[model samples]
Target: MNKLLLTLGFVLIPLLVIFALFMTNSVETQITLMCVALVTAIIIGFKAEAFKYDYTTFLFFLYLASFLGILCLIQFLFHVL
Candidate 1:
């Protein structure tokens, strides 16, 4: 169902990023997965748009990317410190 896919898309992005971080010890891999998750979430949200000028889709991507970025930055800082 569309709703399920939409929900999965919402959930999987962060999950994948975390998984990438845990599975790979490389910052590059984590960043790559974060970007991939952001793009995939954007595409999925766009496709699942059920309303005009759906701002929720934009917010979803924004929040996801921001969260991922913050997580990666924290990890990097900890690594450097």
Candidate 2:
């Protein structure tokens, strides 16, 4: 169960996010952005673990916020520029 959650945390969640972004724009740029954010979250979560911090729950929230923030920023930028 732990391994499954970790895999979902590190892999499936990001894949779903990227899939959603692709569905939204069907553009390479949006896909790339989502992939980058996913990678960033994975790196951060791993780092927190390496440092022996109790970060699993917090990492999930952080990843979700970061994902939403990036999407919002992309939409805002597209509208503004």
Candidate 3:
């Protein structure tokens, strides 16, 4: 179960986010996926860890996801400019 959750978090979510970013061409869809990814990361970040090492990865994921919305805005601005 732990491995499965980790795989979904580290692999699946990013894949979906990247796929949405390039494949949709819809800014709304891109933002929604990024929001979902951020929410998932937040859930993982807040879960009580079964092991000490768990927080390490979750923290990193949270850190990265926290910037996703800002990244979306920046990319939009770049394209507009």
Against the unseen true structure, what C-alpha lDDT does each candidate score? 0.78, 0.61, 0.69
Which candidate has the top score in TM-score? Answer: 1
lDDT of 1 by residue, 1-81 (tens): 768778988798768877888988888887888888878877777677723376776775787678888988997887789
Per-residue lDDT of 56 in model 2: 60
Clashes of each: 0, 0, 0
lDDT of 2 by residue, 3-39 (tens): 5545556675567666656556644555556666666
**Model 3: what TM-score?**
0.69
- At residue 32, what lDDT does model 1 achieve? 89
Evaluate residue 65 in candidate 3 and report its C-alpha lDDT on the 0 to 100 scale. Answer: 69
Worst 10 residues of 1 by lDDT: 48-57
Q: Pick the candidate with the highest lDDT.
A: 1
Best-first order by lDDT: 1, 3, 2
Estimate the TM-score of every prediction: 0.79, 0.45, 0.69
RMSD of each: 2.0, 7.7, 2.9
